[model samples]
Target chain A: MLDVFADYMTYQVFEITKGSKLGDAVNFFIYDSLKIFIMLAIIIFFVSIIRTYFPPERTKQLLSHKREFLGNILAALLGIVTPFCSCSAVPVFIGFVESGVPLGVTFSFLISSPMVNEVALVLLWGMFGWKIAMIYISTGVLVAIISGYIIGKFKLEHLVEEYVYQMKVGQNEIESMTVAARLQYAKDYTKEILRKVWLYVVIAISLGGFIHGYAPQDFLADYAGKDNLFAVPLAVLVGVPLYSNAAGVIPIVYALMEKGMSMGTVLAFMMSVTALSLPEMIILRNVLKPKLIAIFVSILVVAITLTGYMFNIVL
Target chain B: MMKIEILGMGCQKCSTLLETTKQAAEELGINAEFVKVENIKEIMKYGVMSTPALVVDGVVKVSGKVPNKEEIKALLNS
Candidate 1:
């Protein structure tokens, strides 16, 4: 049905030739925009409802005092369901620490929460096939667990700021809600997320449409192709400094993949941009010492780069 | 008289919560003292991991989201 509408809008309403580049771009944009918005609305609403059940406070309680490896695994998995925002990172970090959640476990949650988010998953599944999406999810969680475990093994607790250890966090009751309230919250949260991301999604898809129509085939293959050894690391390096939500980045990833950028390199780039950003580094610096931050970044960069290379070889 | 404390680390939602809570208090004709707790240490003292938490008379009423005006009014009344 959407394909028909896009065909009609491109061929009949616009009067562009059926096989023209402009027609192709416009058709791609219209179809993708409609499909993405629908997917985003439904996915975000359900994800928001699930989020209400796993507040950070409850997650803190669950993970506190667990052994390191198991805690890291649980934290990484729970990171997907827990509601988190960078703005709340400090309080959450402190809360985790004060509550005796292992630093490594906390890092696992931090790493996976932003990297394996619903928006990224939805966008990847929509743009790419479910197989690729599943690959991204599994690899993302693996990176989080391994990187966090490595950090824990390093025993870098002393690298945290002194104040984070000294701070005494009081306990507050989790807010309870009725079914109607949960539904309402989901509705409101979905609207809020859509309002925030719709513009970025449109802009990204527009750029993607342009690339899809105009960019010559195999343009990026030579530079960032599967055989290029530096491609994955370079992509991660470039992605870390730039901050963008998954909605804004996935369209570009689609365009890049279409233009012959290797799948692993593009995926790594997307993960780097979403998971390890300069602004988040600055925010984390408040709690983590410079040395710890550097180590964390290095570990993630290595882990993401390895995942990229692994995908390149396997897929 | 009521004391309403908005706990956050100065994020956008924190200010929005403050504005909505103040409006709710005014609509209810309740004399309220509003405090914006922006310090991380201060916010941690409340034990709320998520921000934009509403506290009435030092009791945490809500955390992690900005309730609508009607919801805020209900909270204030309660």
Candidate 2:
């Protein structure tokens, strides 16, 4: 229904404007904006409700003292629904540790929370179709699990700030919420998220529209082609410092893909941008020592790079 | 009058706890003060590990999970 509406509007505009540059830009913008916004609203609403079930407090309880492999998987999965903000990094870390959640399992949650979030999934699904979205989700979760397991193997718990280990928060009471309250929570969450990123979505879609209408078709393909060995790593490196959620970065991703940037490279870039950003790292630094942070970054970088190469090789 | 502190980051659970606690207090017709402690340092001071914790009169009552209104009422009375 949405696609048909978008297509009809674009078609009408193209005819009315005689297929001019303005027409093309307007068409691209209208189609992308309508599709993305609708998708965001619907997906975020459902995901928000799901999130109400898996708050950090609950996730900490589930993953605490869980065995290594199962813990990594569960943590990564929980990371999907757990609502985590950078500012809460310190307390959540302390909370998880005090509750016996392993450092590596916590890392899995942290990595996947940003990297494979609902926002990223919905945007990818809306713009790129489900095939690429599925691939991104699977690979993202896999990377989180593997990286966390690797970190766990190293037994780097001691590398956490000494203060985290020493601080103990005794168990507290768990609250049961009514369905109405849960719905209200979901409503508020969706509003908060949409309010934060609405402008970014508009800007991103507008840029995407401009690129779709005007940019040369072969720019990225010729330069950052799949055959280029350095393309994947370079994209990841560039993406790390540039902080943006999947929704905010979708316009660039769309433009790049249109320009023939390989899926592997784009996915790698997206992972690096969401999961390995500098600001998130600094926030985590309050809980993790420098050495542990370095290890985390290196593992993620290597894992994401490998994912990129695998995609380039296979698809 | 009673003092109630909801300790957690401003996540959904914390907000639920806040509302639930408020409702519990209102149903019981108890005059109470509700405070949301978002600062990590202050929350840690209470030795509350998980988020969405409840503190009554500066005593840690619950640490994690969003308890229902009935539980809140019991906690409030106790």
Candidate 3:
């Protein structure tokens, strides 16, 4: 009976240790997790410097008081430089309105905030290549500009909050500080920001790492990565409802590439998740009514899908 | 204690920074009262050009990017 029990225990151990997936997951958690973490650290440092240079109010002022298309174009341009998302959203929205910037123009700024972040761009360059990074950045800027202009042309002024019109542009609260004060401020805020989302980045990157290291190549090529006619549109559709951001998504993109997912398909998905997340939509509801939000989401979906297809064709 | 704020408009990256920073702190044996500064005005107050910033003891250590647990640990330890 004792001999029988030992045999059963050994069999159980063998079963647990035999699968390749378990080893993959373990190795991934160990090796890939570290790489993802390091990348995130670098991004955090870059973001810190940006926080020190551009404040939301400053960006808002730049985008305020311009022709709709011009302002939207400017906002998209500024969005590339400026940091922060929802925080900038309402403030920029209010600032633009107070300065008579067009609604569509402001939307451009809003759209680009999440999609074309600086850190994500850098990581993409390192992970994929500069060509792809430039492509992503240009396309992101283009989306912001075009979408903003389209909404501006419609003169969707009525969609803005009444309070926004009445709101005055407040002077930046931290302007009087010395250099030391400014540096201190940046460091403090960087820590705060890092505190919130580092884990998710790690988790997402771990998944990415796993994919990078272990996902099957031919399976991916045949399915998600292919230049199939439906691939781009399908990727967009799949990406839309998901809520992972670029930071989390990029590492995964590396994995996807290994798994045979096309760069274009992954990008479409990342764009949707970063720019049009469900949470962002929910927050927007506070400032924008459901109708406006729905329109925005719809437009983004189409734009992202088109972008994906275009990329696959061009690349 | 470290002061941390994530600047991105509440995206997953921002959220990831929060969790990873804490993990870093714990791994390095430090205590921090982390703050999430979601207000763009507040982010601008610190002059953060990027969302999701990391501040240690009132210093802007990282911004616009997420850090891994070990990196966070190093920041705390250093």
Measured over all alpha carbons after superposition, the RMSD of each candidate to the real structure, in angstroms, is: 2.1, 5.2, 10.8
- Model 2 per-residue lDDT tens digits across residues A1-315: 765665677677445463677766766777777887888888899998988787677888899999998999999998888876665667778888888998889889889988898888877887778898999999999999999999999999888888777775655455677899789878877887888777877877776666654777878887788989999999998988787777777767877888889989998998999887787787778778899999998898899999999999999
Models sorted by lDDT, best on top: 1, 2, 3
Candidate 2 CAPRI assessment class:
acceptable
Candidate 1 lDDT, tens digit per residue, A115-135? 897888777877787788889
Candidate 2 chain A: worst-modelled 10 consecutive residues by lDDT: A10-19
| Candidate 3: regions farther than 4 A off | A1-47, A161-163, A166-174, A189-215, B1-78
B11-73 in candidate 3: lDDT tens per residue?
677788888887777776676787877765555445454456776776667655566677677
> Which runs in model 2 stand beyond 4 Å of their true positions?
A3-15, A18-21, B1-41, B46-78
Relative to the unseen true structure, what is the C-alpha lDDT of residue A301 in candidate 3, on a scale of 0 to 100?
A: 83
DockQ-based ranking, best first? 1, 2, 3
| Superior candidate under DockQ, 1 versus 3 | 1
Comparing 1 and 2 on TM-score, the stronger one: 1
For model 1, the stretches where C-alpha displacement exceeds 4 angstroms are A4-24
> How far in Å is the alpha carbon of A141 misplaced in model 2?
0.4
Model 1 agreement with the true structure over B1-78: per-residue lDDT tens digits:
799999987789999999999888898999999999988898888898988899999999989888899999988887
Best-performing candidate as measured by TM-score: 1
C-alpha lDDT of all candidate models, in order: 0.89, 0.83, 0.67
Q: How far in Å is the alpha carbon of A274 misplaced in model 2?
A: 0.4
Candidates' chain A TM-scores: 0.93, 0.92, 0.77
For A114-186, candidate 3 gives per-residue lDDT tens digits of: 7887666766765567798889989998988887787777666677556556554434333444778566656
